[model samples]
Target: MNMGTRTDSRFMHLADIVKVNLELEQDWTGLAVHKSSPRGDGDCDGQKLLRPLLSGLPPKRLYIHPDDQIDMIKNLTGPGESETEWVLPLHQSENPTTISMLASLFDSLPNPPVPSRRKRIILASVHNDSTVVYYIVHDGLVKPRQN
Candidate 1:
């Protein structure tokens, strides 16, 4: 199947993973999880994106870009529940390069909120083999920790 046809299903797969992962309390809680449609394309059915619901904090939005489209926003989360909503954004990966895409994806977000003066996005990259890698991507430069 072509990439376009595959995109929708991939998002569905990823969303389910995100829901289950959150339910397990891996890093986030499953406080009303659901997907949203992509903004500019009919190809993207808008079911892969997610938003906050009953999180007890505030509302948040999750943006998922197309496979070939990297110049668009990939993820977003509203304020109030910055800490709680930070654990979403799951990307289904077919390979290792998917991890690298996180950088470009995060760069395209539209007016991403800065929680406590820090800008960051959570990436849950699921490989084709069913292995998923989680990452916290910061908006700008980060200082190394001394431990």
Candidate 2:
């Protein structure tokens, strides 16, 4: 397919993801779709294929670092308000996403509210039936939360 057709297909998939999220009860806010531009000559050519990413704030905190969880327990403080998070929408039928692509996406984002916090994004896998399965994806290794 031509570049325009490919671009249009990606946009439609992104729209579907947004629509499914809006229809859910999470009350997503400050929704924004980001476009990526190709970088100058370098080893970052893969970044050029990076798709648009969705970013917004959920109604409640979706994740807390293991260290933060301990701090919260010690301080007897409840989980804080949710922060804006990156969302990558991928159609199930699409080719498997590459680590380099994800790394590029992570690099594009601004630092987290807490400097100690790790970078993460919500990976939304859209299915043909309009089902969107979300998974938390961190940029690097992080201690898993205890039950």
Best by lDDT: 2
C-alpha lDDT of residue 102 in model 2: 81
Per-residue lDDT tens digits for candidate 1, residues 1-147, read 597557756566566666565556444444554444322434434434423211212233332223212333343432222344443445463443444454434333333344434445566666666566766556676543321
Q: In candidate 2, which residue ranges exceed 4 Å CA deviation?
A: 37-49
TM-score of each: 0.46, 0.81
Regions of candidate 1 where Cα sits further than 4 Å from its true position: 1-5, 25-27, 30-82, 87-116, 128-131
TM-score of model 1 relative to the true fold? 0.46
RMSD in angstroms between candidate 1 and the native structure over all alpha carbons: 11.6
| Minimal lDDT window, size 10, model 1 | 50-59
Clashes of 2: 0
Best by TM-score: 2
